[model samples]
Target chain A: MNWAFFGGLLSGTIMYGVPLLYTTLGEVIGQRAGMVNLGLEGILLIGASVGFAVSIETGNPWLGVGAAALAGALFNLVYAFLVATRRANQLASGLTVMFFGMGISAMVGRAYVGGGIAGLARYQVPGVAALPWVTRTMFNYDLLVYLAVPVAVLVWWVLYRTRWGLSLRAVGENPSAAFAAGRRISALKYQAALACGFLAGIAGAHLSVALARTWTEGMTGGRGFVAVALVIFSKWHPLRAIVGALLFGGAVTLQLQLQAMGAGVSPFLLNMIPYLLTLGVLLVWSGARRFAAPGALGRVYSGEE
Target chain B: MSAFTSPARRLRGACAAGVRVVRKGWAIAAARYAIVLAIALLAYAVVLLLAGKNPLQAYSDTFSFTLGSWYGFSEVVVRMIPLLLTAIAVALPSKLGLINVGGEGQLYMGAWLATWGAITFTGLPAAVFIPLLIVLGFVGGGVWAAVAGFFRARGLVNETITTLLMNYVSPLIVGFFVYGTWRSREVGASAFPQSAAFPEAARLPRFFDTRIHLGLVLALILLLLFWFVLEKTAWGLKMRAIGGNPEAARRLGVRLGLYIIVAMFVAGGIAGLAGMAEVSALHGRLRAGFSPGYGFTGFLISWLAGGSPLGILTMSFVLAVVFSAGSLLQITQGVPFAAVNVLMALILFVVLMKPRLLGRLS
Candidate 1:
């Protein structure tokens, strides 16, 4: 492939990867607090639709992002009540939330088909966007591309450096110990799940309004689930999750590029690459080392229990 | 004075305790069904009102369309065939505590494989080719499911995620063959992405003058087989034990991994058969949207029925009725097909939230 082709691949990969980065990072934070929100996909769908609608109505992308986050938080509230308070089965409840969110979003977004909203405009930092190759490859992109990196770093700092992170990790590892230390375990878990929802919502918004620039039914396109897979692949590390997202993004970009080239390969088989890669990664990772999940993950822990 | 007071006091205390327990149990069940029903009504009202029609009228139309005509009734049964098969796919693995969300993928794989088989062996006798195609479909689904099981058993990878991710992968594989390599030349239409039509020999026999076929009978047979295996056999006993308490079952000498794998295989095989039935009996070809979300709908039904085989049949027919009605609602009331989806989701949410709502009520 020529340099131009390689550059196109790089740009496409970054665009594709940004959404996964947001979601996986969000999941990393949630999992650190010992809560697995399988409803991440649901949140994404709601976010995408709501974000697209709001942005189109107001002509402000930031407003759309805020609305998307609120939608996600609202979805998470239902999940928080079920898994965190009532102690329903986490997986089942998560799946229910997913179905509900998907249905609701599709219904709500039916009118917004073919509508386009301006996405986050690319920021030109002093001479960065001016560079010949690097400009298009890196600096010339949507605001989400810029936000994804800092978000990853920020989450890492909160998880490892802050007292709140310590409390959250403690709650995940052993809620009893955290409760003994005067930490409100349930409160912390609720907060973490809500935060995860917000981030996931932003990811969804990025996909529809920012990236695709249009709203369509079921537009999240399994990216949210892919983010969950990335979390497992990254072993719940924020920075590593970003890397995993880029890897997946690269796979997606490759598929598109191959299609564009008319390489005689089936686009259908090419699309399967990322999922097959995820399964392969899980198998390989599990075989190499025992990835220690949060002890309280997916379990409803009452202080009494 | 002591004898009279003692007997009366005992009787009053007994009545109070009995009333409390009974009230609690009834409250729980009531909350569950009430939530589901309320959601269903709310969704219907919203859909009908938005379309500028009365909800009751829309619903009445739906019912009439589904039940009023022999033709419509046959169509409902035809729709129920795939739903029944997919429900069995979900219900089987669930017995072992494994959720096989990859049924959609498996269904596609089976349909794709069956189409390939049918087209390749076009001139064979119906008796020989038909059975071979069905078996091929079963193998296709079974092998796809077994891959997930292998990862779960040996790698300790979570089956839920693995199965879910596999779902995304499977459709693409099917699309690749239909769109790229196996695109029908005779039709010569890029807009219609579908495989070559299956041969006459591979086609399933119709049940009546309607499109309903032997697939419905096969679905009923599978339901009975599943019920017998789950309720009457040693394998059923082991599956329940594995699902209920895997660690305890393992200590008791149950081969946890083996049974899980087997359960998944059976689940996939049933799902595959559903796909084959759709291709052979209904559409006579594999096309995009051939499954028409039947796999996901089946998941909802299987879940609603709590994995009961008889319940699967009942729920499948109920869903089939709703679907038939929904399509009719679209034609008469201009309500979107998605309205039905909203209702289904609402019902599922109510079911999931029922216990807690009841607990609070009591």
Candidate 2:
């Protein structure tokens, strides 16, 4: 209702949207490159827990983010080998990795509960923080908040404008043809998956350090799956992922705000908003446009195939 | 003599070729499984060692907790109820190349509906009420899963993601009811957000002087029925055809969309039965967070079994032991319940690799 309230909500959206954005963008890259890492959530969980631990141990959040990315890449490499190289069922293997990630995160993070560590330090723009218009909306967050958009735009360019992006898309659309055309489909796929994992790690680290600012088991809180859904809504485009993530971010923020408004609504119903919106968007978007997944999307690709 | 020698030499060559082919396939298949099992065990051992605990002692403690005594055996049976039924939920859909990961959601919906029925129909005899409640639970879970199926059929939405997201919704729906309309105001249960206990008339009868109830019998019967349907029936054949290749099945005039919806309904219905049995037999009340990842455990079970009906039972027993043991380990060894979760997940990863390698080898 008020300007200040609206400004706070916008800030909250960015804060929440950054993690979702990172995940969706990463998923788009993986799915577009013919690998759907259902293990993205697992990667996030592992990343979040490991990142938190590393950051706590090292006394630096950036180091935590770096460790998270490394963990994500290592975890995703398994998926790349199984689904990409071994040609296993993507859905099953992805789900398998997810369960493993969750289990491992819980197993490792159980000790970190109540560890009481400082979170990511907000790097406010010196002049921007003093400005009346931008102070609440943009100036008060970690560096990742600023980095997310430019990185997304860069991903958008690489996906559409670059020759390597063309080959990557070709690999997803038709691996045999791409292979015949002298493209290294396997190499492209591995790169895409690993890069996606790196971003997922950053997303997980953001959730643990910048958002929740503490270690808790399974704390990624289904955001990875939400990001997976977000990619479909984005139609595998990096730019659209940004929009989808923010919209979801807003939808979630609105729920909390509505609860704060004391509008005689049950908290249980409020919890349903984000999930319901995801399903609703999925249904509506499918009817509106055929969300054509990569032709070779979940298939195992060997050069022979 | 020359003609006889030529014929004998040809036969010997053919026999050697046959043996070589058989040995190659068998060796690869064996190696694949061996590698997976070895790796899973090694990883777990490494983790245990890192934690400064002895894996062997933990395993033995887990052993005595689940497999060593009659009481432990009963606990295993109790754990297997929701687990096997929910595994069927995934197994059924999987046969049609559809992944129904919403067993958790369906289970909660079933329990919620059964709870509602129990409270609303308090006057009926247990015989009448229990059957009525079971049907409600089935339909509730069935319809919940069917929503994802319908969207998949008509909207072309990926059922995997839809069902996964729906899982998050169903529990909250249950929460809305129990926390609102079904919240018991009785002094004993008022502090908790839960439904009132089912009337004595509505409770399920027990078996063998233990907490293991009639649900175990129901699960066994259903598992056999599941085998019959999957292995021998026309519908089962059709499901296998669809899963094998949907385009081919559709070309043969199989109604792909309808079959998918039906498969999901059947899957959801079984999960619902699990939820109903859990409440009516074991808890007698609907409480928040009632399921501690039983649906996910079921998903793992179905994957481990590779959708084979009888295989589910065997895998279920093993996991039931692991689960019962994990809880015991949590108390006796002061180890986290998560260690079991980790171990189960790793087993799934190892098993999932088996079929892929088997195909390559054999």
lDDT of each: 0.81, 0.84
Query: What stretches of model 2 exceed 4 Å from their correct place?
Result: A125-138, A288-291, B1-39, B356-362
The runs of at least 3 residues in candidate 1 whose Cα sits more than 4 Å from the true structure, single-residue gaps closed, are A129-137, A288-291, A302-305, B1-35, B43-54, B187-191, B251-253, B356-362
| TM-score of predicted chain B versus true chain B for each candidate | 0.85, 0.86
Top-DockQ structure, candidate number: 2
- Score residue A268 of candidate 2 by CA lDDT: 89
- For all predicted structures, in order, the TM-scores are 0.89, 0.91
Clashes of 1: 0
Q: lDDT per residue, candidate 1, B1-362, as tens digits?
A: 25656877888878998899889866765555466666767765875576466988877776777888898888999889999999999989888888888888889878878888988889999999878888988888888898888778875687888878887877787777787767777745546887777788899889679999878888899999999998999989988988899999999999888887878887888898889889888778778766657877888888877787756877788789878876787677666565677667666666666644423310
True contacts kept of each: 0.49, 0.61
For each candidate in turn, the interface RMSD (Å) is: 2.9, 2.2
CA shift of A150, model 2, Å? 0.5
**lDDT for each residue of candidate 2 in B1-362, tens digit (9 for 90 to 100):** 25657877878877898899889966875566456656776777777778777878877777776778888899999999999999999998898888888899999999988999999989999879978987988998999999889888885688989888888888888889889989999997989888998999888888888899877887888889888998899988998999999999999999999998998988998899899999999999998878878888898888766777766887788778778867887787776776776677677666655556434310
Per-residue accuracy of model 1 over A58-163 as CA lDDT, tens digit each: 9998899899988888788888777777766677667777876776787667778889876888775567656666635555687778878998999999999999
